[model samples]
Target: MRFKSIVLVSHVTDLSGPSEAVENYLKTRSDRLGVIYHPFHYCADRRSRMQDYRGGTLLREARQGGWNLPALATYVKDALFTLFYFLRLGGRYDVYLGADPLNTVVGVVLKWLGLTNFVIFYTIDWMPERFSNKLLNAVYHWLDRFCVRHCDAAWNISPRIQDVRRSQGLPDAKNVLVPVGVDLEKIDLPDKSASEPRDLVLLGALAPSKGVDLVIDAFPRLKERFPQLRLHVIGKTPHDAVEDGVVYQPYEPRLAALGEGVILHGAKPHDEVLAMLPAYDVALALYKPSPNNLSQWADPSRVKDYLACGLPTIITPVPEIHKDIAALNAGIVVDYAVEPLADAIGRMLADPGQWRSMREAALAYMRSYSWSSILDRVFEESFRAKA
Candidate 1:
């Protein structure tokens, strides 16, 4: 009812994370809902790429970015080529949405060319500090400012990110709080709970930023309290760069010393993880505070997933969900240290009554973070651009 269609642009090669969320939302709306959709992304293989999206197109120059300088060149080419692709579309879509700066640049240029009525730049996980050099960080900072200045609206995943934009001299009115929300169907809680549960799960990539080592280090104390508390690292290994970190350098060997309590289940399918979550008593998303965390840029999904499975969560300050975890009695949000983490989990497990109450609260809180509630606001704002 708002716009003719919405075009989402991202340079990400995978449709697994955020892209998968978008696709799930698309399935709910009908062709007559006037919610026609389009997606723009990178694909190294044209034949295999864009197969998931009916209206999506491949960025011909798009190659996965690497640590080398060619990665920088490949990104620049992707952004420049996206501009050409936009023009080639003859402005078919009414609203333009982009995930990162380069994609935002393409949307901004589309708006300038009168190809779209509104330019919505969705700021998800951003980490200028993750860059290897100062020059690249500085360049990304400038590009971020450019997007903030040019876009008609900002769809930010975290409220904290708005402060980052305002510091760049943008107004609060320009930024809309749009959480990277969860799909209700996919994240449904299993009917039955763990009968005699004493397991904890830390989901997501095993990265330095993710604080996998912090969890491991904190576990010696957690294990002392709950001897039956098995910790599951349920995700893939960190990026190649981070795998070389002191903590992750041959993580298996380092993890082996932690003993039989810790289980490293590398990267499971989405459905399997959801189903497996209720088997654990506590879910962990304890990211160590860093310039590279999703805390400021996006709402971390692991927390949402854990809650949807009706498991109380243990998290650090690095996730945007910490406040909710604290306020709603959902779970523990403790300092990123060994003693504090151990104390929190110890307190949580010591009281079976409190843990049961928090488990219920976790599901209730997760209801608010569903995508069904957020997508309407996203489209409502996009449609209002002309008004």
Candidate 2:
């Protein structure tokens, strides 16, 4: 895996989103000279800087508007800034691993400028429909297609996205399936908090599109069935705005005639969240399909976190993510409807043997998704190409 240099780039500098994967990937090759371009702070609630690209430099921008910009404007600015920084700061390298579409677009520009030998596009999720306005969606679609056309190789996270790119005229040879990876060391994590087992948990942003309401709705019925069932909601939110059974829904209507037994632990450190995964029976990741979820191959990192902890996941049909879970029988896949979700919960709770098997299967699946192997393959494929 020798090279002149290898760099990874992303639009966001926070440790929360795709940058988390970049950090974990760097851990596998700490000795290598790897640069990372992540200039802006996207998380205001926490000041979590991404891990420095040790043995190399971190290219950053001088201008940033922080996290308060309008959604469409934010992405537009991100793409523009990524191009600006990469053009100015990117040095000669063998590969520039892009952690997002916009950054991959920058990689394309870098390749055209001869700053890098190869541009590898690494994306966990994408869909043009994410933008609400028609014109904005058109701009996103055009920029994404530009990325698809120019990158030397693509590390697509979802099989569904592979299909999407194929339909959009990407050749089969240009794309490879590279699912998200987890730190294998997180498998048997020591507890950071002495918390009792929560029967159910959802640990991510509690935004409307995340399907938080469905989990809260399922809780009342789930508690009735299991008696000791309690739902743990952990992640970022707008305010201290949650009650036991009565949850807030700013984007959609509240789940009426739903259940209770909700406990809001709010947000915790990333390490703390992973540490607390062992104290939960099931990890809930209910991302509703289509418009609710903006990804063609929806990235459910929360699902990966659950599997890394050996917890059986209960997920909605989240595109390719659901298929992976269902194929391995790693967990249950239920409809977003409260009744079906509640039924799945009851089924898991009623059958301990099945639960154990699913937990085992989840661990087995994790064994195959090591970041070390994934990164090696990414580098190998990127450099060993015909170009």
| Alpha-carbon local distance difference test for all models | 0.66, 0.66
lDDT of 2 by residue, 97-173 (tens): 88666678777777787877778777666775745667876876787788888888877778877888899787777
Model 1 lDDT tens row, 184-293: 67654554443545788888765676666777787887778678888877776533434222444645556668897988886676767876777778887777776655
TM-scores of the candidates in the order shown: 0.81, 0.81
lDDT of 2: 0.66
Q: Which ten residues in a row have the lowest lDDT in candidate 1?
A: 32-41
